[model samples]
Target: MQEQKRPQFKVFNTPELLETILLHLDNRTLLVSAQRVCQTWTVLVQTSPAIQEALFFQSQEHKWHAESISSPIYNPLLVQAFRPFFPSVHEYPPIHNNTNENATEFQAEAEHHGRDEDSHFSFKALDMLSSPQKKTAYMRKEASWRKMLLRQPPVYGGVTIFKMHHNMGGDSCRSYEVQEETPQANQENKESDDDHKMLKMGHFFTAFIHNEDLYFGRFGHTRIYWSTYVPPYESDLDGRAGGSYPPQGGSYSRKVIENFAREIVRSEVVAFSREVTQCCVGGKTNLTQEESLRKEILEAESDDRV
Candidate 1:
């Protein structure tokens, strides 16, 4: 007998009930793509801020957690890595993704730890992002990333690609590209006639958020050049940026990635909130602090407590 067909979930269930179901379902790719097929779904999804955040904010509640600093962007960055095995980009569309809610222990580990980018990594990181148009790009442990990165759409126009680029224009917002120095490069810098920069590469990117254009490849971890946001983030405090990142540890690569990832995500969210404001030519953005001129509003909570 033909399986009894049922009404679409949206048609049968109320919005709140539907959202509760969406919250439990681990099928993000299918759900996200489905939102595009109908006005009802599109509105239901876009209006639900919780669902929007859930896409990027992997959580234990959803049975997903940060097993590695690289987990967040691993999907997109590893697309090139999985290309050779899959062979065709068209094969990895959003619809046919097999998302088992009951993922195996090792499978979850791979997803959290970046779908094996570390295993097949040729150098310290993975290889370059061979353009999708080019045939036979190097993929990490063929078919490994496919589990996590269900869909590999083109860079610019694909709806599934992480938001193409943030466009909050002004002098305050600044994009950064920080390359980690190898041991040889570190020694070379020390021997140079100029001052020595440590295992710690000198911080280059800084801004008061509202001041300029922003384009640090948040997810571009193509082993060729991994971009990083060097920190103690610049805040209202002078010279010192706001949040202090953990010190560079040759052994603790995971720690370094995790700290920077949090800071990067937080900074991106702030810029989107319109919190970044203007300043004069020689002035700084003072971004982390909100705009508050009133004395009571500006003072510390400890002042009231005391």
Candidate 2:
């Protein structure tokens, strides 16, 4: 009986079996914990195409046919990490966070949502935006986000940027939406005779990482203000505020910057900003003529802030 002892079979030691097991894990766990288990697990996580797509490092090409209203999931890590920059109505209530006008309403709504200010997700978002000290670390060349997609389905339409301007009279928004023209259109204009092209998500990432100042717009009760500058954007159709964003004179020209900004404000306007901009002034969805003008200005301004 003493000589009858048998060797133990280790299931995880098998790479094929282990990869199958790991494929079941959520993205956060794979990145945070499983990858650290051992070198084998790490390699599997990094090399597995399915796992890579799950982490949003690679596009889910097969899922393209299945794309529905919510078929493709938003990159959860990006949603959490860049939460402030990508505001949401369900997550961040449309409230004047920096003001006290709707204190009671905002408090009640926040409580209803069970908003946990101390949560790690909230902390990360706040820390990224408010803490300049950590920017250097995040800006590293090897940062995980450098290769990550902004959206899991991958934004093939390209990225749009908006800049919002703040002022006493009223806020205004401008975008380089006009810059994303087709080759035929570009040929027709001929004004933009260079190799200037539309900015993509990768371009946004490059610009964001290199930039020192973080420019975001606040959708207040009645207005959208790009907190970068205290002045209004240039009124000219192609004019841009010096040192505003999308950075002028390089791959992203003034025209490209303008068009991108416009696209973000209209199509991808922050949910929190949109709701607050609509309801904050009077808590009314119906806008008066004056309020309507303010909303219009705010929408335009929202793009600049992007």
Candidate 3:
């Protein structure tokens, strides 16, 4: 006896099918394959905000994005650049008299946070910068001086009055005073006052805020300078200008920075392709080997940490 033919399953609607495919496409290859299936699939993959956001978040979570990695890790740089400013508590003796009172106050303020003696005075600086309501009582005690210094520029005339002061424990801090320049004295005079004035105009502060800690630094010289890395502008691409490259014109603009980053990414992609080709030529046949190579490529493309 002839058995009844099994009923054929109906194909899902296009959107439903696309969604199902997307759900299963955790791997980049499979995702690309789904995109190539049809015009509808391609458009859905390309234009869906939810899908893009999810992909981006997942890639970042997996450390797959290059720009994310290349962003300069600022903490080390901050420590290096500012550490020399503070006096070391171990090598030198503490100041005496009324000045000793200020030192004690500074020490107490620093210790109240429970930070180790060797920690940079950045915490103190940050404390000073903090809001009135948030500042510790000790910080509030010295609020007037902090506020005055914060309001004033560190450098004036032909000298930088803010000399680096090291505490007894080797922590660094800045102390402000007039530094008179004597023409006859032995000092490094790399640039004239006129040159410095020109450079000041080119200088900008780049501030980076990470995990509630704020780092600000001056970059550039007479030809060009960058302001501290502030929070990304509304128009900023990839945010923080971390992946951005200096433009040819020696100026920082959104378009130029974006283009610079794109070019770097493009170059990285080209290099990655060459490496893959070389690996294949070397007779590497394992899929895992290939995947490892690809992962390395993606990492190399990620942000350049200074």
* Index of the highest-lDDT prediction: 2
Candidate 1, position 29, lDDT: 49
List TM-scores for all candidates, in order. 0.25, 0.47, 0.20
Model 1 TM-score (2 dp): 0.25
Query: lDDT (CA) for every model shown?
Result: 0.28, 0.44, 0.29
| Model 3: lDDT to the true structure | 0.29
Model 2 scores a TM of 0.47
What does the lDDT come to for candidate 1? Answer: 0.28
For 117-150, candidate 2 gives per-residue lDDT tens digits of: 3221122343333454444445444567656765
- For 1-306, candidate 3 gives per-residue lDDT tens digits of 123332222222355555665766653543457677778767776566445433331112223243454332122222222232221331223322234344345344434643332332232333222454433331233222211111011222211211111223332222121223334433356544322321111011111111111111111111111111111122332232233222111223345444333333222110000000121335434444323432332333232221
List, residue by residue over 62-110, the lDDT tens digit for candidate 1. Answer: 2333343222232333334333222112121111222232223323343
Candidate 3, superposed: residue stretches over 4 Å from native: 1-13, 57-169, 173-306
The true-versus-predicted C-alpha distance at residue 50 of model 1, in Å, is: 2.0
Q: Candidate 3, residue 94: CA error in Å?
A: 42
Off by over 4 Å in 1: 1-13, 57-306
